[model samples]
Structure formats: structure tokens, C-alpha cells
Target: MKPTRFIDSVNCAIEGILHATRTQKHMRYHFLAALAVLFTTLLLRVSSMEFMLLALAVSFVLFAELMNTAVEIVVDMISPGYHPLAKLAKDVAAGAVLVAAFGTAIMGYLVLARYVLPWQKAGLEMIGTESETGMVVSVVLVLIVVVIMKARGGTGTPLEGGGVSGHSAVGFCIATSVALHTQDPLIAVFCFILAAMVSHSRLLLRIHRPREVVAGGLVGVAITVAVHLLFRAFG
Candidate 1:
């Protein structure tokens, strides 16, 4: 085939796959799952540069999957007959996807666990739910869930009830904790702004719906309120 024709074919194949990906729920699930995992594992907060690295790695896996599918389709079209070399090529492509996914998972676990483990221990200590401990516990729990969902490929928004709504949950939880710890309205206001931005950004990115964002805001506010009350009770 001519160069133009070859390029056109490649574009058409890509278009078809993307089209199918959007319409096919399963494909979307796979894509979203990967994204969610990266998001939650990295805590999806406006915290650090490590999260950006995690995001890049996850994106690489998705990109590899798309490329692998394209290569396989093109190969099949070129040589319909079974061939050893063709099989080898396909297998190699698949192996690439696996390697990318595995690496992504490992990085996620490392980055997340560094923060998640301690948070888990603290959360388990919130039985009374009547001290700064309670708020800390709530935040830790949310963080843990976010890490798990991200590693496992969830679709929650970090505050609602799904993959990573824990972002909002934990955000609010921390904001409240900070407010209680400092007992300063200015600090509380700052935390609230940061939390709100995180929630809004999640929706703006189209990674979450409106319900998810609202829930995150509410969760943060609620956590703050609860912690304030708990502290007041003890004081």
C-alpha cells in the first residue's frame, strides 16, 4: 500500500478503537479502573510531585494497551494466516502491557503505603470518636480506602461512596482536625479553601460527577463539625 493509504488505515483503526472504547462499558471500566487506581494510590490530593509520577505511569499503561491493540489489528490485516513470528510479536506486545501494569502497581503501593500504613493504625484507634483522634481516624480510613481503590482500579470520586471520594472525606477530615488543633478560624478557612478546590478540580477534570464533588465538600464539612463537637465535649 502507498504511504498515505497506510497512514489512513492506521488512523481509521485508532478511531474505531476509541469509538468502541467509549460505547463499550467494559472498555471504559478498564480505562477508568486504571485511572482510579492511580488517583487513589497517589491520594489524588494537591499534595506532592509523587502523585504526578504515578499518574504518568498509569497513563503509560493505558497508552500501551491502545498501541498494542493497534499493532495486533494491523498485523492481522497484513497476514491473516497463522505465523510463528506474528504470534511472537503479539505475545511481546501483551507482555509490554503486563510489565507496564505491574510497574504501575508497584509504584502505587510503595508511594501509597508510605502514607497509608500509619493512617490505618491511627484510624483503628477512633473507637470513642470523641477526640482529635476521631477526626484523625476518619481521615486515615478514607486515605486507606483511596489507596485500595486506586490500586484495584475503582471509579469513586474521593468523597461520595465509590473509588476515591475519600479525597473529600479525608480532606474534610484533616481540615477539621487542623481547625481543632489550631483552633484558629484563619487556618480553618484555608483548609476549607484547599478542600473545596480539590473537590472542584475533580469535577472539572471530568473524572467525577457533580454528586461526587458535593459529597466531598459535605464530607469535609461534616468531619470538621464532628471533630469540633468532640473537642468541645472533652474540653
Candidate 2:
């Protein structure tokens, strides 16, 4: 393509992004979240590999949200009325955004949790950690339960829901498990603080309601605690 044509295409893409940012509240939230993620990455001084992963996750979420907006706009233009197919199309597009958002949240937690909860390494050493199998299993269980709840509620997709904050659930599960295994008061406090921040982020982003956040945290705490108890009893 000619330089002028390429420039026009770039301008059109920029205009679309600006239009979506202006019109879509969720898009604004995603932009803010991306900014916060970038700021946190800078503060943590993550390695180049970690930085690349974080950047890619952030970009994926924004791209998904933009595509979702475009899809909705196109569906509205074409259908222009309450049609089942149009609704399905919009929901599928929104689901894509939800998937991206959920993936980003998990990635952010994995990348940032260590930096924010610096005591975790010490705790792990103190516990003489055998394996992360228990924690991993607990996380998987929480996710399954959250997905089931969301499906039953029919309010949102499995990845994004008003039922429970999957991000908080997984984050706190790991945090609480680490705290319990370490049996350190300071570690426990810091872990809870980190978990609280995760919960607060969901509320701050308006992705989940206050009840949902609390429920998720409670679910995480309960599952982790139970798993630890069982391990102690058996082993």
C-alpha cells in the first residue's frame, strides 16, 4: 500500500480506539487496569521475560475488549433490533473479552504476587515445602466451583461473573495456603493483605460486586485451610 494509504489506515485504527474508549465504560476500565499493571511492573522491577509476559497479557486484554466493542457495534448496525442471533453474537464477543480479562488477571497475579508478598520465599523455606501440588489442586477446585456458580447464576460468562471473583479466589487460595504452611504470623498478615488487595482490585474495577469479592475470598480461605488440615491429618 502507498504511504498515504497506510497512514490513513493507522489514523482509522486510532480513531476506532478513541471512539471505543470514549463510548465503552468497560474499555475505560481496561485502559486503567493496563496503566495500573504497567505501573506495578515498573515498581516491581520485573525481569525482561516477566515484563514481556505482562505486556503481552495487557495488550491481549485491550485487544479483546476493542474487538468486542467492534463486534457489538457491527451487530447493532446490522440487526438494529432485539434479535436472538444478535444477542448471541454480542454475548460471544463479550465472552472473548471475559476470557482475555480472566487470563490477564491470573497472569498478573502470578507475576506480581511474589514481589508484593516478599515473605513468601522465607515461608516456603521454613515449611520445607515438598511440592506445590496441594496449592495447585486447591486453585483448580476453586476455579471449578466458581465456574459452576457462574453457570447456575446465568448472569455472566464462566470467566467473568457476578457470582464470585475467580481472580480473588485463586490469589487468596495461594496466599492463604502459603501462610498456613509457614505458620508465621507476619507471613499470614502479609498474605491476607495481598489477598485483600486482589479482592479490592475486583471491586475497584467493578468486575465483581462487594458480595462476590467477599464470597470469593471466603471460598479461597476455606478451601486452602481445609486442604492444609487434611494434609496434616493424613501426612
Candidate 3:
């Protein structure tokens, strides 16, 4: 489809991503790995320069993979028959992805090595965490996303599994909010433990599967962490 409007162009780009993610397991893996790495940067409080370098490396790998996927699709479409040239094209594209991935891995290791804490690190103690405004925004945003997820799934009510857990989501959201606001590792640990119990009850009662409860908890925690990170990153 030809994109005539700005929104259409954006939609087309997102569609490409969706198609790639659905069809390519490697793309999905890279996305999950990138998410984990980005979250680690947040937790480690890496310098902005280091974060930018890591982000660039991630982008380079993703870009190479996307191009490789595009090349493979085009090659398959054009050469439905078995041909050495087609195989070579695919192999070369795959090779590009491998090289890009390897380089990015090295870059990530170098950037993160110094930031990683030693094995004998001191006890966990976080101080002067995010502001009140960030905490409030995070909780509100988590609630909004939870509702959206529940509505989109439409399989079960908020409290039930099959859908986002109204109880577990809010429980985790509040727990995350309090944890960030308190700036105490022990407090954060305790709050998250409580949140886990709330989700566990859902599992024991059979109102939702373990997957559903875990999904809800992840949603809440992810949203809260993202909001706090945004606040800390910009303000």
C-alpha cells in the first residue's frame, strides 16, 4: 500500500515491524534482548554518553537485521526456484547480520564492563529516588495501560486471568510506585514480594493462569519503570 499521509507512513513502518516480528524469530529475540539491555542501563544508571553508545549499537544491529530480512523476502519472491545466486544472496544478507551482531556485542560489552558492579559489591541501598510527580504519573499510566490491555483482550474481566488482572496490575503498580518513591532497596524488595503474593493468590485460586498473572505483573512493573526512567532521563 502506498502511504499518502504522514500517519499512513508511520503505520506502514509499524506494520513492517509487526510482520518481521511475527515471521522472524531472530527479530523477536533481538527485540527482547534490546529491551533487557535498555532496562539494565536504567538500573545501572549509566552515563548519558554510554547509554547513547549502547543505543547506537543496538540500532545498528536492528537495522542490519531488518535489511537482511528485507533482502531475504525479496530474494524469495524473485527466485521461487532453487538457484545458487538466490542462495548466495540470502547467505550474504545473513552474513551481514552476523557481522553487525558481533560488532554490537563487542561494543555493548566494552560500554557496560566498567559500569557492572563487582561480585563483592556492597549491600544494595538506593537513595534519593524519583520524584513524587514521577511516581504519581507512573501509577496513573500503569492503570491506563492495564485497562487498555484488558479491553483489547476482552477475554476475561479485570480480576480474572485470560485478561489483564485488575488486582495484580494495580498491586504491582502501587508496589513499584512506593518502591521508587522510598528510594530504599529493602523497601522495594518487600513491596515487590507483596505484589508477588497478590499475583500468586490469583494463580492459586485458578482465576487466572500463571501466564496471565505474570503478564499482568510485568505490565505494571514495566510501565512504572518506564515512566520513572522518562522522568529521570528528561527532568
Candidate 4:
């Protein structure tokens, strides 16, 4: 049977996906591992909004991968004889995917830290305990990014996970940390509200997408949970 143009396009896309899986098997494995960690440590414990954010980020990565595959195929077709420009184009496409994957992983880590290990470390009665240290770390990290962005005189890079905007990572961490420690429903509500506000601020300030903000939030909460589990196992 002859395939229609639409059918052919669909087949090409499916082939692209399969080719991506076959050629980038290690990359796919890494993504799947991250997803596993994300689901177990972050998604399970967060609010519905957090889960939505995770879904958005994951979708972004998948889209990036598809685009990357298309770019590679087009480049190969156009310059089958091998040209420097073709190599550059393909490299750039692959690089973009790497950046996206790296950003998502970082966001996942931040969320896990917050939800999994919100409290201070064991045997700490000092003024600057582990929890205090974590807060300080957060403050410093945020300020550093803000300062760097200011120094750059621009956003630096507006990729899906570039620039100093740690919307998904930091927001998730802070929100999850607050949610885990406080017993009151009001507290959870307030914490998430604050997180959402911060996320909105990122978009308003033109630093991130709604997706990025949500990713940060999920990563933060997930990280908290992961850390808690780790501590329990080792301690």
C-alpha cells in the first residue's frame, strides 16, 4: 500500500523517535533514570501543581529531542557528502538536547533535596544548623544568580534551562522544605502560594516559562524527599 504524505510524515517522526532511542540509548537511559527519581522522590509528595510542572518539563525535553532528531536528519540529507557546516548544525542540535537534559536533572535534584531532607541534620543545636545552612545556601545561590544576570547586562541565555533563573529548582526546594516541616494545612497552603508567586514573578520578569517555574518547584520538593530517605538509610 502506498503511504500518503501525512502518513509518511508520521512514519518519519516515528522513525526519528526510534532512531533517537537506538542511537542515543545512553541518553534515553539517563532521562529515564531521572524520571524515575523524579517520580519516586518528588512527584509522590508534592501538590498537584508540582506534578503538572514536572509533566511540562518532561514534555519540553521530549520536544527538544524530537527537534534535535529532525535537525540531524535534515543536516545529513542536505550534506551527505560531509561538510563542516553540516557537522556544526548537527553538533548544535545535539548540544541543545544536552543542555535541556542537564537543566532538568538539576531541577530534579533541587526538588528532591527540599522534600526529602527539609530538616536540619542530626546532632545540631548550634545557631547555624544544617537547616539554617540550607536556607543560607539558598539565599546565596539566588543572589549569585541575580548578580550574574545583572553583570551579564542581559539574560545570558534563554534556553529552556539556561540563564540565572532557577525558578523551578529553587522555588520547588523552598516550597517543599516548608511543606515538609510544617504540620499545619495553612502552612502548606501559604508555602505553595509563595512558590507560585515566585514562579509568576519569573515569567513576569521574563526570566522563565511557566514550565520552568514549575520544574524548579518540583525539583526542590523532590530533592528534599530524596535527602530524607538517604539520611534515614545511612543514619
Candidate 5:
């Protein structure tokens, strides 16, 4: 019996993912970072929205890295020797990952700052307190997660192709955080509008597909909400 088209397609995708993961050291770093983020999110009891944003950011970086890898692979296969166009293609692909990484870093800072800034304002005693301690710890852990995730997901890495949009994720995360922190509805609304603009820019640039942008936004909102709820429940 022969496999159906769907089955074949699924198998091929799985094979590609496996091959990329196995051969790419960068992919392993990303995987570890993802795990760290997930673990810290749970540990800190971050709001659902916060967790979602983190997850989306992670996914986006990995996706970009994977796509970068794919592009490099294709370029190498087509032009095994040095070629200007091939170099350009690889550079462009790597540039995409770099852009995503920069966005992810910004998102990480926004998310972590939510905790660190408040704690700092309260002084040393606040840092010593259990709640503040937990928040600080969470921030540190989240940073670790971002660092690991961003370490390598770019062209030339083994596992690279199709990632979530870090720009979208960061924009949404910032919007959600602003909304949650500010009780003023008008302010929240304004922040959201700004975030939407940021997300729209990604689409306008043709750097990300609609679904990828939407997914990134959803993840940011979900994670933020989750983190808030969890902290409320446990704290």
C-alpha cells in the first residue's frame, strides 16, 4: 500500500524538522531556551497573556532560524561555489533572523521590566521580600530563556525555516503589559493602537504572513493574561 498525499506531506515535514534539529546546534539552544521560558512561566505563575507572549516570541525566533536554514540549504544546493547572488540570498536570510532576534530581545526586556522596575522602586527591602524575590527570580529566568533562544537561530544554522514574528509578539506583549498595568482605559486603548501599528508594519514589510502575525499577537496576549492570573492565584 502507498501512503496518501497528506501522509507523505506530513512525513516529509517531520523528516525535515528532525533533520534540522539533529544537525543544528543552534536549534538545540532554542529548544533549551523554550523549555526554560516555559518552566519559568509556570514557576512565576505569570499571567496567561505573559506566557503566551513568551511562547510566541520563542516560536517566532525558531521559525525564522529554520527558514534561514532552509534558504541557506537551497542556496548551497543551487550554487555550491561562491556566487554574489548566493551570498546576497544567504545574507538576506540571516538578516531576517537578526531582525527577529532584536525584536525578541526588546520583548524580553519589556516583560522582565514589569517586575524589575517595580521592585527597584520599592528598594532593598522589597527585593528581600518573598513576593519581590519571586518576581526578580522570574525576571532573571526569563532573561536566560531569551538569551538561549536568541543565541543562534539564523541562516547557516542546521535547523532554520519558518518562525513566528518577534516584532508582532513584542508589540502585543508591550500593549498587553501596558493595558494590564494602567487602569486607565483610554491609555490602554492608545497602547493597543500603537501595538497594532507595530504589528501592521511587519505585514507591510512582507516579513511575515498574516497568520504568523496573528499567532504572535495571540501568544503575547495569552501569555500576559496567564502570568497575571497565575501570580494572582499563587501570590
Candidate 6:
């Protein structure tokens, strides 16, 4: 339908985002990565100029990805079969996204390296006390991993039923992070119990099989623990 008003235009824009997010795994990954980067930036408290640069880098990559998806769709519809020109068009569009992503990665490293490397000065004993960074990284990694799993398995959409349950993964991920940061047995046990309950709920609803839920919980815990250890070692 043609957009007839400002609100209609906004809704149409949102629909495009939703379409890309649902159909394109890379787009979903970019969205999650963008969130993680922005959250880290807030915690790092970078300079205004640095913040603007990071924001622009993120926007550039996302824009490139969206354009790539659009180009591929158009090419497929126009060609609908083997066509060297269509293939070239899609490849060129994909190459643009790849270049944008690479430049964004370099920009991010230049902006964040100074702030992150300073963690070496902090004592190891004191490092575990800060779980914010570890938790954020763990959750983001789990989400990305889940997205990949869903895309590969072709079992479900991004949010609901999948080969691995993202909700379960994130639930257990945060629980493990909390347990590690607190270093209190009581809190650890409580957190695991909550995580288990969350995983079990998926089973109860029959949204996920026992193995899928278990796999998600295990993935969550494994990723979170690895992240915690890395932060402690470097931070």
C-alpha cells in the first residue's frame, strides 16, 4: 500500500526494518552488534567526538547492509534465474556491506582500544567485581550465536521456537554472569535455579524440546564463563 501520511511513512519504514531483520541474518547480527557497541560506549563514557564517530560508523554499516539486502531482492525478482549481470549486481552490493563492516570495525577499535586497554592496570582481584562488561558481551555473543544457529537449522524465527532457544540462552547467560560476579554460593544457587526454571518453562510450553533447552542453557553458561574469565584476565 502507498503511504499517504507521515505516520504511514514511518510505519512503512519500520516494516522494511522488520522485513530485513526477519529475512537477513546478517542484518540481525548487525542490529545486535550495534546495541552491544552502543551500550559499551555508554559505559566507557567516550568523548563526544568519539561517540559521534562510532555512531556514524555503525550507521554506515547498517545502511550498507540494508542496501545490500534491497539490491539482492531486486536482482532476484528481475532475473528470477541464472543471469551473470544479476549475480554481479548482488556481489557488488554485498561487497559494499563488507567494506562498510570492515571500516566500522577499524573505527570501533581505534575508539575503544584506549579505554579497554587501561583495564590492565586494575588488579585481577578487583576485576571480577565488575560484571557489567562481561555480562553485556556474553549476552550479545549468545544472541548472535543463537541467530546463527536459527539461521542454520531453519527451525524457527528469531524470537520464537528455534533449534536453540535464545530466551533460554540469555536467561542462563545473565544468571551465570550474576553468579560469577557475586561469588556468593547462595546467590549462585538462586541464579541457576531461576535459569533452570526459565529453561523448564520452554519445555512445559512445548516450545522447545528438552535437548534444545538444555543446549541453549549450556551454550549460555559456557559463553558467559568464557567472557567472565577473559574480562578477569585482561580487565
Q: Who wins the lDDT comparison?
A: 6
Candidates by lDDT, descending order: 6, 2, 3, 5, 1, 4
lDDT per model, in order? 0.66, 0.83, 0.81, 0.62, 0.67, 0.87
Best by TM-score: 2
**What is candidate 5's lDDT per residue for 49-97, written digit by digit as tens?**
8878988898898898899889989999999999999999999988998
lDDT of 6 at 84: 95
lDDT of 1 at 78: 82
TM of each candidate vs. truth: 0.42, 0.54, 0.51, 0.43, 0.48, 0.52
lDDT minimum window of 10 residues, candidate 3? 119-128
- Can you list the residue pairs that collide in candidate 3? 158-166
Residue-by-residue lDDT tens digits, candidate 3, 48-115 = 99999999999988898899899999999999999999999999999998998989888877887666
Writing each residue's lDDT as its tens digit, candidate 1 over 129-165 gives 3465666665765566456664564554434446445
Off by over 4 Å in 1: 1-17, 20-29, 38-46, 122-235
When 1 and 2 are scored with lDDT, the better candidate is: 2
Q: How many residue pairs clash per model? A: 9, 0, 1, 25, 34, 0
Please rank every candidate by TM-score, starting with the best. Answer: 2, 6, 3, 5, 4, 1
Q: Report each candidate's C-alpha RMSD, comma-separated, in the order given.
A: 13.7, 10.5, 13.5, 13.4, 16.5, 12.9
The RMSD (Cα, Å) of candidate 4 is 13.4
**With candidate 4 superimposed using the best TM-score fit, by how many Å does residue 119's alpha carbon deviate from the native?**
7.5
Output the worst ten-in-a-row residue range by lDDT, candidate 1. Answer: 121-130
Off by over 4 Å in 4: 1-12, 41-43, 119-235
On a 0 to 1 TM-score scale, where does candidate 2 land against the true structure? 0.54
> Model 5 TM-score?
0.48
